[model samples]
Target: MAQLRQWATTLGFSQIGVADVDLSSAEPGLMAWLARGFHGEMRYMASHGLKRARPAELVPGTVRVITARMDYLPASVAAEGWQAVEWARLQRPDAAAVSMYARGRDYHKVLRARLQKLADQLAALIGPLGYRVFTDSAPVLEVELASRSGVGWRGKHTLLLSREAGSTFFLGEIYVDVPLPLTEPVTAHCGACRSCMDMCPTQAIVGERQVDARRCISYLTIEHDGPIPAELRPLMGNRIYGCDDCQLACPWNKFAQRARVPDFDVRPALNDPTLLQLWRWDEATFLRLTEGSPIRRIGHARWQRNIAVAMGNALAAWRDRVLTADEASLRAQMVQALQAWLAAPTVTGEAQAQVAEHVHWALAQQHAPQ
Candidate 1:
């Protein structure tokens, strides 16, 4: 077990644990959240039904599951400068705020390959194991399993939290038939800290360990399809990809560790990019830049839709401040991008009409009485 821990650490994993397949305790909460329609348009969460809690039922012969957590803070993030950098991004209305996690190579690819390698190493010792690896895949109760296995206690925000690593990490699981010894669960350490709840822009974290994903900015920007809710659009701030307010506000994150792998480093296009600059990218450019990114999964249409909201947020921010030539240049570039989008042959009927309306509104704002 000590050897496994050392090996996992060398592979960039912060911690590893073994959890039993019996997750009967979490079934009720999962059902209740689904019943409340908190999942919004993500029907798969409901579609999977109770199978998410019953690992053996989801995957036959799974007696034990090995869970791993890998810290994702970029190596480039200065120790004392993390919060300042994130706050600065939030203030720049023209800048698109992608969740720190998604700015890197798709974590799904990175974690899965490494996890399979770990499983292969185990097989070399024990010979012929029935195992399957998953990282954020559907039909998995990843966080619940990780917490139960002592990777960390569940935070008030409901994400698995570690004292040494906080919640800024990726989780991967290996379901196997072997009955590996289980790890001791950790006690919750949230105490009086409600910062994650208080800082949630959309009030998505309704209570301790409860999040209404329907109202989460991360859900709205990424998982959701169709029109974004009007009420929530303004609350999304400048986050064009995913929101990290809850995570950023947590005091425990002061202990968040940096990623050892270069694969988790920020891509230039996603780092400190202006809303107008990203909005200017055509479908081809979007595809080329986001080829290996999780953002690419949403495709170009949703990407533009997200950027349009940020552009709207930027316009709203500029309205409150005295404008400068640089700001005016940004607004002009936004207008030009909207016009280009309007002319695009592949723009969805719904998105095309929405873009046209936003363009007209933006143009009217330019000429409105000050």
Candidate 2:
């Protein structure tokens, strides 16, 4: 077990644990969450059904699962009181706020490749091992697996929380037919803390350790397609991508660790970018800038739509504030950006029309709050 830890550390994984394939205890909760229709538009989650809880069923003959954790905070964010820095960025109405995790290379790619390498090394040692690697790519109960294997306890926000790394990390799993030694589970440390629920801008965290994906900002921005709900737009503030308010609010995050790998380093283009800067991007520019990035998955149209929503929120947030000469000029520039996108689009077909609708909504925020 200790030897496996060393190998994982060298591969940018922070920790590893062995878990039994049986997850019958989690099936009820999974079914309940699905029954309530809390999964929103992610039909895949429902389609998989209990296959997520039964690792052995997903991969035939699997008897044990290996869970791995990889910290992903950019090296630059290791400064003291980093949560304050993120809060300051979110407060700036005209500044585009992207989730820190998405500021670099796609996590799915980074974790998946490293996990495969780890699996390959294991196979070479064991001689023809049958195993499958996963990193948020399929129907699997990742948090349940990690929690059972002592990686971390599930927090009130339903994300894996670590005493050493907080929740600023990615998780991956390997299912194998071997019956490896099982690791003990950790006790929950959340106690009476409700910081994550209090910090949610949309009140998405409905109960202790229960989140409605329909209201989750991360799901709404990254997963859902078509029009964003009008009522939720104003509450989104300047967050143009996935949100981090819950993780930022958790007290344990003061201990968050920086990624040992450079793949999570923040891109120069995403660092404190303003709404106008991103709003002016043509489809080609968007693709070029987001190459090998998770943001590219949303395509240029959704990117523009998200920014338009933020731009509208910015206008509403500025309506009551006294403006300086530069502030007034900034406001005018934002208006021009919205109007220009409305008039001439760089996207085509349904994408262009959807973005156009968002632009019209953005242009209509004069007396409104958002």
Best by TM-score: 2
Candidate 2 residue 223 C-alpha distance from true site, Å? 0.5
Report, for all candidates in order, the number of backbone clashes.
0, 0
For model 1, state the Cα shift of residue 61 in Å: 0.9
TM-score each candidate.
Answer: 0.95, 0.98
Worst 10 residues of 1 by lDDT: 360-369
State in Å the error of residue 204, model 2.
0.6
Tell me the lDDT of model 2 at 22: 84
Give Cα-based local distance difference scores for all models.
0.86, 0.91
Candidate 2 lDDT by residue in tens digits, 1-370: 7777888999999999999988999999999999999999999999999999999889999999999999999998856798999999998888999999999999999999999999888887777889999999999999999999999999999999999889999999999988879999999899999999999999999999889988888888899897989999888988989999999999999999999899999999998899999988888899999998999999888999999999988888777778888778878898988887767787899988988888888877746544
Residue 106 shift from truth in candidate 1, angstroms:
0.3
Question: 259-339, model 1: which lDDT tens digit per residue?
Answer: 979998989888788887787788899999998999999888788778777777777777766889998888777767766
